[model samples]
Target: MALIDDTRAILGDLIAFPTVSRDSNLELIAYAADRLGAAGARVHIQTDETGHKANLVASLGPETGGGVVLSGHSDVVPVEDQDWSSDPFELREEKGQLFGRGTCDMKGFIAATMAMAPHLGDLDLSRPVHICLTHDEEVGCLGARRLVEEIAGWDEKPSLAIIGEPTEMRIVEGHKGCCEYTTVFTGLEGHGSRPELGVNAVEYAVRYVTRLMELREMLKGRAPAQSRFEPPWSTLQVGRLAGGVAHNVIPGHASVDWELRPVSDADHRFVCEAIAAYARDDLLPAMREISADADIVTHVIGEVSGLEPVDDNEARRIVSALTGANGADVVAFGTEAGLFQKLGMSVVVCGPGSIAQAHKPDEFIEISQLSACLDMLQGLAGKLSTAR
Candidate 1:
């Protein structure tokens, strides 16, 4: 059978599962496990605490050190508020594109890996080719961390990993780290008639927001002049804010959810410490004047660490060879690549569609793009066959 045939079939099946981050992906995990097992690979599943979501790892070839990993997430973003012509879980083909929720962002890559299964069965690989699929990638790359932890304990860890996020098949060697935080401010509430008698939580929140803005500017100004990233700099944004319920009363509490995208891990910590300092020195004392219980609480929503490009590693050479690109570049978005990198793998981000189509109402991957991805995976298989 043709590679495209298997990939499309698998893509159809994968999209059928509503593997939204908030939902369990056990169904999808089971389906993947079956496919991998049938393909003559050794499959192992790591489930979350509730045993609802799962991370599936399958290996083709020897169990010893040094191999390649084809990694992707099983979760898709929600389609609730989006307007779509068809159900998000159902694949729709039109004008040489496959329309579906996860097609581009990216069940397509998972399908491509599955398409390599038959070829893998035929190959006598000395170095294993491991396929790592995880859930909750959309929810801050959560599942991959645990999956990486599992991979770290393997008898022979894969030397390189390819994170199959949408990149039109170009090799992405680096990306920014994202750190999300939710902060809550507390104050004593009093009637609006005597504002001085109570601390206004909303007012403190504004100050906190203002301080964050200043920090954002400071970080932006310190960004290096050279970068392959789109914006080429770190960024910060306040995503949500909630507080008061009535106009005549001071809000006892206010909360803000914000995030920072840093160019490196060190930069991420620096920003976190900066926020912590601001809450302690500037906001807390003023709040305590109104009530001893008044305070600001800051906690991490989640963080995706950045990947720094490796210099002429085997992984880079393989990706460049597969994509036929003169060079690889870095992205501004966060990805699961850093986690694999944390496991001592030289990782790159390269896959089928454009990220522009991701998380949109009408998500899709071009037929040609899917074909290209199959070629890449197939090409990798050939490389392994020879390298072994």
Candidate 2:
């Protein structure tokens, strides 16, 4: 069968799994593992503490140096309120597009890798090819974090990790880190008539937000020279702030939902340290003086590392050659490529579709895009072939 046909067929089967970020992806993992294992590739499944979700790592050819990883998230965003023309879990083909929930965001790349499974043994490869399918990427890149820990333990490390994010098959060199947090304030409630008698949680939350804005402005000055990202700065936003039950009552509780998209690790650290010092030295002392029980807590939703663009990136170079791209670009969105890059592997984000279609109603990847991705993979095989 042609690679395109096989990719289409596998993509349909993959879409049928309906592996949303909030749902278990073990079934999908099992299917991929079985397929890779039958193709004489070594397959490993790393399940999180909850066995319901898993990451599949499969490799072909020798397990040693200079191997390349084909990576993609196996989970999709939800279709809860989306108005789709057809069932999101069922793949629908129309006018050269394959419509499904995960089609454009990621599953298309996974299918492209799977389509190459039957021919794994046909080539005498000098360097190996590895496929990594991770769960919970849409949520927080939780699965990739765990999967990288497993990769760290391997004696032989892959030299490159090509993250199959929706990059329109163009090579992407960098993206910002995503860090989300929820800060809660606990204070004593009292009559509004005597504001000094009690600590106002709402007031403190506003102060915290003000501090965030100060840091946000400071980030602009610290932006790396020649940064590729638009606005070219580590960005911050306070998504929500809530407190005060009524005007007459001093609120006992307040919470702030906020996020930081840091362009570099140093920027992330600087923001975190400044916020902690503000809370510890200034805010906490005053609040505690008023009420011994006054306390503030910060909860981390997720802190994904950023992929910084580098001059000596093998993955970018290889992908550029394969795709005939003249230069690499950066994106605002995050991907698990950073996690793999942390392992000292050159990482690049390149895959078949536009992210504009991801997480939207009737998400899709064009058949032409899939065909182009297959051609690139075939080119990669040729590059890695010992026969060359």
* Leading candidate by TM-score: 2
Cα lDDT computed for each candidate against the true fold: 0.87, 0.92
lDDT of residue 218 for candidate 2:
100
Q: Distance from true position, residue 41, model 2, in Å?
A: 1.4
Cα lDDT of model 1 overall?
A: 0.87
Summarize candidate 1's per-residue lDDT along 1-388 as a digit string, tens digits: 6778888888999999989899999999899989889999999999889888889988889888888889999999999989999988999999999999999998999998988886897799868888989989888888998988887887777898888999999988888888788998888888999989988999999888998888888887767667666676688899998998799998888999999888877677777888789889878987887699998988777888888876756788888888798888887677999999988888889999999999998899998999998888877888779555
Clash totals for all candidate models: 0, 0
Candidate RMSDs in Å, in order, are 1.9, 1.1
When summed lDDT is taken over every stretch of 10 residues in candidate 1, the lowest stretch is 224-233
Per-residue lDDT tens digits for candidate 2, residues 78-174, read 9999999999999999999999999988999999999996686578889888899999998889999999998898888888989999989998899
